[model samples]
Target: MEEYKIRIVKTIQYIDSHIDADLSLEKVSEVSAYSPFHFHRIFKLVTGETLQSYIIRKKIEKSALHLAVHKNMEIKDIYWDLGFSNHSVFCKTFKKYYGLAPTEFRRSAPEKFHKILQIQSKNGQVDTVFSQYICNIENLLNWTKMNLKIEVKEMPEMNLASVMSLGIANVEPSFNLLIDWAKKKSLFPRENVKMISVYHDSCKITPLDKVRIHACMLLDERLSKQEGEVFPETIDGGKYIVGSGEVTLDDFEQCWVSMFLWMNENNYSTRRTFPYEIYHTNFKEHPEGKMIVDFCIPVH
Candidate 1:
């Protein structure tokens, strides 16, 4: 079952990282190295949805994030890029997810996403409770102004040895696994070896229980190999909105909000890429349990 978890997590990560991969059931099952039936069973057991359903759910959630934040991205771009067969299917799916038409979602973005990317769930009960703090934390901009020297910088491309961790709750366990493995391979020649994480799905849009994050260790150089739980992958070098600060786990959400506010005020939009964070110092090792980190938002 643990092996099944690895296979499913790796397969999902592969699909997200590639972005252009064929999404047909046959291809996905093949990628998982399991028979179609077995793949479906395992994937559903791990993710709580069928593979196709999971894919569609992610696409729809991502689309909602776009519609909610980036007014410049056309609906057609969202629908087509996410692999919807036609406009009709796109509209139907959009309504099914948000209980409104795509245009309606955009027109009502303010009401839909209360503040920045805060989304109210269909029932308007659960998400409303989760997002209550957004309004309360209006001074995150002050936090940013005081604590972070924000900059737009070019990040270098990286080849990473990564461990896939499901559920955001087990972040420490995931990093522990990666660090223990890295010690065996002697990759940490210095105390400052970079520790990075790429969250495959946004927690605001996706359920916290189902979110997937890759716990990635930066290798000293470009090398590629597949070694059991560890796999090789490259992240793109691009312009990013970056800020480094001493933040506890509690400050992360606020920091992220401040960055988004900063981006919006400064006329930058998200570049349709996965964002990442660089841990300058490990929070677990710190006496005060604060992460000295640079949260990088990929942008044009």
Candidate 2:
């Protein structure tokens, strides 16, 4: 079971980095070191989607994100860049998923995409907490109310020894594995070692069960894979809008919501990359039991 988790995660990382390429089942299964037949079943069982469906969904989501963020990129260009051979087929598939045509969606701009929907859901209660891609805009209040720092700057690439956080309630098990690996590698007791969580999917976008979070530590030099569970993935270094704060669990949600607000207000759109949080003071060890964290969003 653990080996399945590790291999799937490595396959996921490979898919992320090579999103625009020809990602056939045979090629991707090679990354997981599983045969196509077994890989299909294991991936579907673990991730709740057929392998082909997963690839298609990721490609669709990638196109949707581009349409939402990079408005200047033409619709044809976006579809073609994502390997969609036929424009009409691409538009149909996109609308089937997002419920809007490419032009209509782009026109809705940053609004419908970031819109925090507040309506009576099928469950017959007001479900206003999570939106599609971002959280409720109301989550922006606490950041201003508490006056945290939000700034934009250039960030360098981070070389990480990482393991995936299985879920919200299951982070500690993975964190312990990473910490023990770091300790054995003498990565601890060092000034530059930083613990970070790189979010590969937004909470609002992916289910809590399937979202990928890399709980990693920065290393002085990226060592070879000495352990199967601990692998290396590099976080891209470029321009990012960051928010720094001493926060609780709820505050962490607001920090991300508010950071998106900051980006929109400042005329910055997100780059096609993941956001990350750099941890300074551990909440468990802090005097006030709060975490000192930097929330980073990559942008063009």
Candidate 3:
């Protein structure tokens, strides 16, 4: 156990030192004197984060340090210095991780971000960063107060082809499968990506297994199956009260939680029937990850 702890510490030190380099799992495991096969599992067991997530998070931490220390630098320079290939990539990943753009974040806390804010003072000064905390129920009530109309629409039942996977959301590999399947069959035009979650327990508070997600599509008679695949199954459908709103990356968590709360309060409950998310816009094109999607929940 002591030896394992030492290995983890060494790994962390190496990561810190090589923040600007491409640090892969194989290289990290070799440096830490651990086998590549066991490295990810052991690292997760010890640190509660995967190597990729850890590296990205640490990069953000280092970026925060640099931002506080050198407020005059350009955001593009910061992006490159932090090892991102380009400004846009850096912005996307950063927004996903931090929920805000670099400019917006700094603007919100100018004092903490001002490089000379502390040194100019006769006595050592402390500055606080503007931070936003998520209030699940309160924020939802506020949004609903916008009197966002309860839009009712009847959606026709349709068959859908789907693939199931573990994990909470889409990432590279799973998305690759979704895209390849869609492109080969040209499913992107007529059909659409419907992310469905059947929650046996609260995903907000419970373990991951309590959440099951299926990447689905609405199929017309034009849809056909590929070889070695079974018949397309009908995504059991029903009436749904749909509510949608736009959320910038910074407000995603608060907005999502609030929407759920609103649904619960308004008698919109999941019936193990029609429960899904229709992603309407492209996430990559949206600045600060602005996305508009409809949440469909069945009600009694």
Candidate 4:
């Protein structure tokens, strides 16, 4: 898994740097040190998207933001600069992905795309943190980087309905079991119920097959303890450094490392508590390309 993750990081860096060039799977596999045939398999397992699909989406997505925010440039110039080769191709792809022509999208959604670019830029700070730690030839060759910043804030304690699952590493299974358990116990009230997951072990340090996960749902005034062997633990909510981003399974290590660095830099500490995840989006609702999970950690 470590080798796979390393290769995945290399692939992302290669695409990021060569966004203007003709980036093909064959070329990417060569750059990432993988066999051409196995490249797609590993890419899918790690990032949940094909290399071509991800690159195209990212290019369109970023170019959309550039067009939306940069009013000084003509829409045709932005399309040409994005390597679309022709106006018709650019317009077709842009409208297919964003549901509007370049001009229409720029006029109607500049503010929305601007905020996305801001968040994405903030998220790219992981590369800066990596430069502080690693110094090696592979680091140069791979350019593995993550960029993210988090802020600290306080939250009040909330009740939760939780069910411990034996399949700890599989997050989807854990959440499914928790929801089913809640349903069986008739404790899934509609109001004020928020889904949460606690990360008890570091995936980078722990084996991916055995990492621990806890699935939970916030309780409201109407919720009461159900009859079963289910356990409820208090999550002492106080000051917490909140970190949120969409990351692939392979990039989980970089995400945690960045968060730890952010916490230490900000002088936040905790004696004993597992950081929790508020799964704001699911894979079924959004394409795997856009799924996001927000991570929250309590601190002193």
Q: Candidate 1 — which pairs collide?
A: none
Q: Provide the TM-score for each candidate, comma-separated.
A: 0.54, 0.53, 0.44, 0.46
Q: What is the alpha-carbon lDDT of model 2 when measured against the actual structure?
A: 0.73
Better of 1 and 3 by TM-score: 1
Question: CA lDDT of each candidate?
Answer: 0.73, 0.73, 0.57, 0.64
Q: Put down candidate 3 lDDT per residue, 1-300, tens digits, no spaces.
A: 134445656676688678878799899989867556346545554455678888988787667656656679888888787788887887788778768877776655555554532333222222121011112223334565562334546656656665554556542344456556766777665534553333223343345643545555555663466433323546445666776776554554444444444444454555567456666665677876766766665655
For candidate 2, which ten residues in a row score worst on lDDT?
A: 129-138
Off by over 4 Å in 1: 1-138
Sequence-dependent TM-score of model 3: 0.44
For candidate 4, what is the lDDT?
0.64
lDDT of 1 at 19: 46
Model 4, range 1-300, lDDT digits (tens) per residue?
144445566677678767778788788889877656445544544454668777878778767878877877887777776677888888888889989998888788746667653433344534642332233323422422333446777877767666665345566776677777778767664554578877777543466777776677776542455536345756777888776776655555445544554454455675477788765555465556444666677778
Off by over 4 Å in 3: 1-138, 145-149, 169-172, 189-202, 222-231, 248-256
Scored against the true structure, residue 61 in model 2 reaches a CA lDDT of 77
Better of 1 and 4 by TM-score: 1
